[model samples]
Target: MFHLLLVIIYLAFISLGLPDGLLGAAWPSMYQEFQVPVSYAGIISMIIAGGTIVSSLQSDRLTLRFGPGRVTAVSVAMTAAALFGFSVTRSFLPLCFWAVPYGLGAGSVDAALNNYVALHYASRHMSWLHCMWGVGASAGPYIMGYVLSGGGIWNTGYRCIGLLQIALTAILFLSLPLWRDRPGNGRDSATRQEEGGGAGDPAPAVPLSLMQIIAIPGAREVMVTFFCYCALEQTAGLWAASYLALHEGVSTEAAAFFASLFFIGITAGRAASGFLTLRFNDTQMIRLGLALILAGILIFFLPLGGNAALAGLIIIGLGCAPVYPCVIHSTPALFGADRSQAIIGVQMASAYVGTCLMPPLFGLLANHISISLFPFYLFVILVLMFLMHERLLKKTRR
Candidate 1:
């Protein structure tokens, strides 16, 4: 039963990742069809991000009312619907309308699943689940690329992915029973407090309110850590292809394919990290990741051309691999399992906000100054993330 739940959670993470890379890959064709400026993509992105933020903030309420399994199933259904909408939309305005549900679904699933794994599973599974996410995210662009190569319309790509999402949603509905049969599923409820663990522990029977969660020692720092880390990760990903083509003089097709190495690195690195967990604690793993991220940025800035940039992106991917899962897995240890659901929800929102704001802001700067500054931008974000995480560790210890 536990293994079955793990399989569902892993598949859920893959679904979470599927849409994330779709827009970027399909936008070149989509904008052409809609007769809109390529920059118009940001509007849809912001709308989705806004919706995600709203839903993520309310995840605890939804999870409390419906349970994680139902929340995940419903969220995936919403996203699947939105993706279908994207496939059928003939113009930009309809696409904007659909993005609302897309973002909301993404956020709810992200918050619900992360908190569930943090509570019920071992730390290694967190890294492996995120690795599964990387697989889906990486597969998205490949699916679109295949469609484009076969002379299919951009909508065909969206349609294919949407259909895949629908199938997963059906599977989710069928698997809802697995969650109910799991142990300790109701432990966080006040009604279950007497049967739950000891009193006065960090994870109380009653969940913390948002304000109360933030009032905990290191809460603000962890929020900052999430924001900075996501900002660094997303910025590197969104800009790497452009940075390579424009800055390193790589061919567009080659750059696009090579740019995927960032995610590939993340996927491979997480598999490696799961093994490394045998020797390293969470803090040690994070510190090692930060060091690799810094090294990757430095390599990225070197004038050695496209090959160096590819190597840098891969190294950065390796660095990013462990940071997210490790920080998330530590939430229960940092505060308590009682507060984890709320904390993880807010963390998802904060991370999405970074993903929403930073990439575009960097684009503005990249437009004004040159794509060459991509490495510099990532370097600054990496430094801030490293410092904030260290502070979080210190505060949690004290």
Candidate 2:
């Protein structure tokens, strides 16, 4: 039953990722059909991000009240409905409306699942579960591409993913019993253990407010570290192709293809990191990842030719693979398991904040200054992330 539960969680993660790449892939067709400017996509994206931030901030409350299993099932259903809404929407306004539930569902499920796995699973499983997310993210674009290539509309692509999410939602609902049957099913039990109470000595689960969570030692540092890490990752992913084309003088088509190497590296690297976690702990894995990111950035900084730049992107992606999962996996240890859910929820919100803000900020710089500043921008964020992570380790040290 535990193994079956794990399988369901993995599928949930995949479902969580499926819609993430859909808008980016289908935006071109979507904009034209709706008679909106390409820039309108950003508006829709911002709406989604805003909704996600709100829901992520509420995740701890919801998860505590309903349990992760129920939260997961409901969240996936919400996302499925949002996707189906996207499939039938003809105007840009309805798309924006659908983005609300889309983001809300995404944020809740992401926080709930990450916290649940961090509490119940090994570091290796955390890494591999995220690898599953990367797989889904990668597949989303391909599925959309296939539909477009086959003369099917972008709506059909959305409908396909929506159907998949509905199926996963059903599985999740059926697996609620598994979640309940697991030991430490409720926050009260988990909090009791964290408080050093034996199973026989029941204790209340005191909820941590956002202010209380932030007041915890190492909490602010870890949150900032998450912000920096996500900022670097999203900025790099968003602008890599443009940087290659504009600054490195790669052809448009080639640059686009090369940019994909970043995500490919992340997916493959997470798979490898799952195995590596057996030997190295989370802190060591994080350090190694940070070092590789630094190295990758330096390579990008040098005039080592276009091929070297491509290699740097791949290396950067590889570096990114371990950092996110390791950070999440370490949350229960760094903070207490009792506080992990609230902390992880805030971390997810912080990550989305970075994702929503940084790329566009870099776009501004690239427009006014130079796209050549891309590597420098990444370096700045990476250095901050490294320093904060080290500080977090020191503060949390027993």
Global CA lDDT computed for model 2: 0.90
How far off is residue 39 in model 1, in Å? 1.4
lDDT of 1: 0.86
Off by over 4 Å in 1: 180-186, 190-209, 248-254, 301-306
Clash count for each candidate, listed in order shown: 1, 0
lDDT of each: 0.86, 0.90
The reply for model 2, stretches above 4 Å from the true place, is: 181-186, 189-204
lDDT of candidate 1 over 70-187, digit per residue (tens) = 8889999999999999999999999999999999999899998998888788788988999999889888888999999999988989999899889999999988767652345443
